[model samples]
Target: MSFLIKNKLGLARTGIIKTAHGNVETPNFAFVATHGFIKSLKEEDYFSLAPELTISNTFHLFVTGKHKEIKKAGGLHKMFPLKNPIMTDSGGFQVFSLGWGKKHNIGKVDKTAKNPACVQPVDKSTRPPARDVSKTTCVAGGVRACLPTGRLEKDRNPVKILSDRVIFTYDGKKFELTPRKSIKIQEDLGADIIFAFDECTSPLHDYEYNKKSLKKTHSWAKECLKAKKKNGQMLYGIVQGGIFENLRKESSSFIGALPFDGFGIGGSFGEKQMEEVIGWALSGLPENKPRHLLGIGAIKDIFIGVGKGIDTFDCVIPTREARHGAVYSMEGRLDIKRGVFEKDKKALDKGCGCFVCSSGIKRKDLRILFKENIPEAQRLATIHNIHFYKKLFGKIREAIDSGKRSNLKKLEKHYKF
Candidate 1:
């Protein structure tokens, strides 16, 4: 069966993206499993998070080893035994992982995927020559990167600045990325669904630059479609055009028309433009296919997108923020590190039914709790944020089940959306 789109509130959706492992409830949050799974959490640990799905990176897995080995060992399900739907990113996000240093500045890259003008002058003798063609950090006009997120982790240079074309040396080796190589890696990974490769234009791009970049991305998406052939596995095209409404409309229409399993609005569109993007997309695209909004999972954002008809959302804020001691609440968030929380407590939240809130009493405020080195604080904090997310969606699912979709808005105000 297709990934089920069960319910809708405004443009946001409460549904299931069914996969071989299981059905991943939609309009969900993703804890960064960038290193395969959350750092300290285990397979059995998922029950507490109760996440509708898990997301990992195709780029990370390929860099570490082959993903086919994962499938052979029973796909990710057997290796991890999480028993929930998992989604794999195509590693397209690395396209903007900027390389910064005195030697490298951000600018338009050429066909070689190298930015020449980003390099600023440095001491000719002390620093590596600006025109050293043999260096791994230069392409055409000559640029370099400081941070390398795209290449094989082994090939990073401590001093090398990582730019689009130039890679840093890790243990004294450099890594390079070409679009063809990325597509091949994703095809081999064999996830239930994979996104097409596209450059993520940061909000910094101007209209002309973003438009040009989106055109290149559109062409690249076509190339990925031509190169990839995954039977039964779905491929979603990403639409990128910063915040410009016209560019968003153009990119959405173009990508939406492509033959694919789904479409993801991947750009600067935020809560303010959620409905605009959705309304624009729905007008030009087919409704049967799923719509994924990259990096959106806040309470208000969910309602805004769902009301506009978005099917799924993935963001690192929930768990990342939670891990840092920030707890999501109805009114806003609790910055657990603040002094106000030192004496306050009361189970993180009174409205939440999560284990953290249910099992607890007050007294272990931030000061005393951290002073005593309590593990419950971290666990309680994560659980509370997770409950806030679940409760937000539970209401949406209930509204959809009852056919009172409009009620989602009435409840959303309490959450500060």
Candidate 2:
């Protein structure tokens, strides 16, 4: 695998990632195809959208025992109709997702909002006995009493984090995933690009926690490299450091020095700190190899990432939001389920070339379909949003290739960013 830079505008550039399956353009978006396919879309629908790249979840396939069938069928391409470049993430994010994310009810981006799942710490005198605690709700003088803060501590997390591996408890069963096992699974699944297994820390984790996690992540990266036996797949090491600038730069320098084909900037941070965090993460990375921003795909964030020299991104925002009746357009997102659109006759987006728009599926029509609980509602919305992102990235590449900053500025205005 090779990354060829065709054009450069500041840190942003237009490039081609040469993969075994095909070439993927730089500053592009990889639509999430979790569970082997994009949810609610059929083969025909996927073919119609014709995404340039798509990513699948390694943990989901491993847990569901689908990797065996895919390996038997000669990889994801043979098992599915998708022929474009595919990327499979290591199950690292599950460390945060299944553990702290579930326990704290938080997401990758910390909004600085208080966790609703958390309660005030209880006074020792007001606390109920250990045996009665299970039978009665935390109450004091007819008011809801605070609970013990220790209940939400690290040990209470459903997923156990270890130095070399992680143990996930799901659906009443425990599954262990090690660095070597993660790489083996990705190799068996046969993707053009695979990620090194690293512990993705949360934005809410304090400095001391992230520092310890970073050491484990760095060790896993080396183990993943040693575990790779396939010469065809390109492995990208991940940089993890939570939200600390020093840790981000340290991880970046360490992972950047590795022999991996490319690099992925993983872990979570506050929304406001994205640009700063990305700068710290990319400071020590080499200029030649491709850099991917994992799990980030907001329109403004894509522009920010590309400007920071990120080559690719993968996120569930487009398809996931589409399934919930949100439609992406030049004007902004539209909620098709809203009553305001019930009598509107405009297309999903004016002058859009997507199948749904070209077919004259008016907002009112989609609104009625969603109201009627028809399955096509989600499919139509998904197709449109996917095309919107495809077109957005195309325009971005064009703007970069043209060597014109004005073109990029025009896109920001056009997208209402």
Best by TM-score: 2
TM-score of each: 0.75, 0.91
RMSD each, Å: 8.4, 5.7
lDDT score, candidate 2, position 35? 76
Candidate 2 error regions (>4 Å): 113-156
Model 1 per-residue lDDT tens digits across residues 13-39: 567766665566665555556655654
TM-score of 2: 0.91
Residue 113 error, candidate 2, Å:
6.0
Across residues 55-108, which tens digit of lDDT does each residue of candidate 2 receive?
Answer: 999999999999999999999988987889999999999988887666545578
Runs of candidate 1 with Cα error greater than 4 angstroms are: 7-14, 64-74, 99-173, 178-180, 187-190, 270-274, 281-283, 361-376
Q: For each candidate in the order shown, give its overall lDDT on alpha carbons.
A: 0.60, 0.85
